[model samples]
Target: MINYNPKEWFTFIFRFHKADTFRKLFPLMIAVSLYGFILAYLELEYWSLINSSYVKNLSLMHSVLGFVISLLLVFRTNTAYDRWWEGRKQWGALVNVSRNLSIKLAGYLEDESDRLYLSKLIPLYARTLRGHLRANVNSDEISDLVEIDKTHIPNQIALRISGRIFELHKQHKISSEQLIILTKDIDVFTDVCGACERIKNTPIPFSYNVFIKKFIFFYVMTLPIGWVFSFGYFVVPIVVFVLYVFASLELIAEEIEDPFGSDANDLPLDTMCNNIEKHVKEILN
Candidate 1:
């Protein structure tokens, strides 16, 4: 995600990042402005609908719909944000679980070979999971460790980690109670993966998303029809500004809804995975 100082309000206003909504919406904003200007000019010069009661009443319709659209956008942005935050929370849990497992293994394992094995395996699980979420698992990364199923790389790594722990218990390297304790942390690895998958697979309803886009389109398109009488030629900028605000909200929502992607606003899966590797190595090696 793009990090910034919250206090630098002026700097943000003056700066325009490539991912900023203004950049994405600028072309559409120009089109909307032209549309609004044409409608306003036609109404004022030729149609002479500026004084018509029907045209005046359309503004009242907009006033009511404006409130309704605000509520819908609020809910849309909130729902998307919830998904993004939940993904972050799941990754946060994975970081903690990796550390806990590594710490326990470091204390329980006596042999240098076993410690080295787990040290590599714990970080491999994190790296594999990061790749799985992005749907671009690197074969080189997987082959460097141990080969298993390619269909589900994370699950294969996780299975290997669990199997090794079980083998240690069988060989009397770690007792039955220590085995139980270690199993708890390993179990959480799958839980975190499943939670991330749920967020990735499921998304906001299709019908609802389409409806919001349609609502914004029609609402902005009709703004010049009614408000031209009041705002006159100035309706062009007013309509464009309104479109900018509403469209920007939708754009931001789309960017953040799938937090696993390469979007600048997405969760920092690469950094988190690297951190997991560093911590595991520090604890176990």
Candidate 2:
């Protein structure tokens, strides 16, 4: 995600990041401005709707619909943010589990070879999961760690890790108590994977998303039609500003709703995965 100091208000106002909604919506804003201007010119110079009560009353309709649209946008933005935050929490849990597993194995395994094997495998699971979430699983990473099914890479890695712990238990390398402790951490690896998949696979309902977009479109399109009587040509900028605000909210919601993707607003999976590797190495090595 694009990191910045929240305190720097001027920097944010003066600068436009590539992912800024303003940049994405600028073309549409220009089109809406021109459309508003055309409607205003036609009404003032030709139709003479300024004196008509019917045209003037349309603003009241907008005022009521404006409240309804605001509520929808609020719900939309909140729902999207909840998904993003949940994904971050899952990754945070994964980091802790990786550390716990590494620490336990380091204490339980006396053989340098076994510790070395886990040192590589623990971090590889994080990297594998990163790739899995992005839907670009790299078999080479898993192959380097262990030979297992590539169909479900994260599950395979978790299984491999569990198998090693079980093998150690059978050989009396670790006691029953140590095996239980390590199994708890190992089980969470799959749990975290399943949680991330849930967030990535499921999304807000289709009808709801389409309804909000339609509401914004029709609302902004009609703004210049009604207000042209009072504001005349100035309705052009007014309509464009309203469109900018409403459209920007939808764009932001879309970007953040799928937090695993490459969007600037997505959760920082790359950095988190690197940290997992670093922490695991420190504890196991």
Candidate 2: Cα lDDT at 136? 85
State the local distance difference test value for candidate 1.
0.91
* Model 1: residues with Cα > 4 Å off, grouped in runs: none
Per-prediction RMSD in angstroms? 0.9, 1.0
TM-score of 1: 0.98
Residue 46, model 1: lDDT of: 88
Encode model 1's per-residue lDDT on 65-128: one tens digit a residue. 9999999999999999999999999999999999988888888888989999989988888888
Under the 3 Å rule for N, CA and C atoms, how many clashes does model 2 have? 0
RMSD (Cα, Å) of model 2: 1.0
- Which pairs of residues clash in candidate 2, taking residues 3 or more apart in a chain or in different chains? none
Candidate 2 per-residue lDDT, tens place, 142-236, comes to 76667764578888888888999999999999999998989989989988999999999999999999999999999999998889987878899
